[model samples]
Target: MPGDALVHRINRIQGQLEALKRIVTSGEADCVKTIELAKAASNAIKKFAQAYVETHLDQCIEEKVAVKELHGEMRKVVHSSFSL
Candidate 1:
């Protein structure tokens, strides 16, 4: 069940996307609502990516495959990615 939390996050994002789709197809889509849902989905994706990468990095470090130097590099990558 270690991945259960990640799966839950994915399901939530999927639900948001489905709602967005339903609204658009219903021909009564509220522009603000659609935008809000879209942004929510986008933020969820970013959060998921950050969590996944952090877990991977932790595993790598635990296994002695990741060096201290990689921390700085990974930090830079994560920061740059979220800056968008």
Candidate 2:
């Protein structure tokens, strides 16, 4: 059920991104509207990433920590995810 909710959110984000693309390609959206759509899409992506990290990465790290396996690989993964 939670995964289904996440997939639904991801699909919604995809639709938002497609709408933003259409706005850019159609050349009908004004600067303000374009900016608003872009910001919304960006925020959605950030929220999804945050959710993924919280749900998946946190659990993974917790598991590793329990086994004293937290290492450079985990740091690299987190750094790369944020660096984008």
Candidate 3:
């Protein structure tokens, strides 16, 4: 069920990407429209990444830290998830 939800989110992102591609290829998008589309795509990507981190990585880190109080491992998880 969780995987299905994740897949649905990914599909929505893909649709946003396709919309962005259409805007670029249509050649009718003005500067404002282009910027708007780009921003929308960027926001979608950010939301997806944030959801992934919160849903998957956070749970994994919590599980690991609970099993063994590995502060360094938890820090590494946080760094890797948030880092570009």
Candidate with best lDDT: 1
lDDT of each: 0.82, 0.81, 0.78
Count backbone clashes in candidate 3: 0
TM-score of 1: 0.69
- lDDT for model 1, on a 0 to 1 scale? 0.82
TM-score of 2: 0.75
The estimated TM-scores of all candidates read 0.69, 0.75, 0.63
Steric clash pairs (candidate 3): none
Kindly list the per-residue Cα lDDT of model 3 for residues 5-84, writing each as its tens digit: 77888898798788878878898778897788788878877787777777787676667755556677767777986799
Residue 76, candidate 1: alpha-carbon lDDT? 79
lDDT tens string, model 2, 1-84? 767767877998999989988988897988998898889888888888777777787677767864445787677777987795
Ranked by TM-score, the better of candidates 1 and 2 is 2
Q: Whose TM-score is greatest here?
A: 2
Report how far residue 6 has shifted in candidate 2, in Å.
1.2
> Which lDDT value does model 3 have at 81?
67
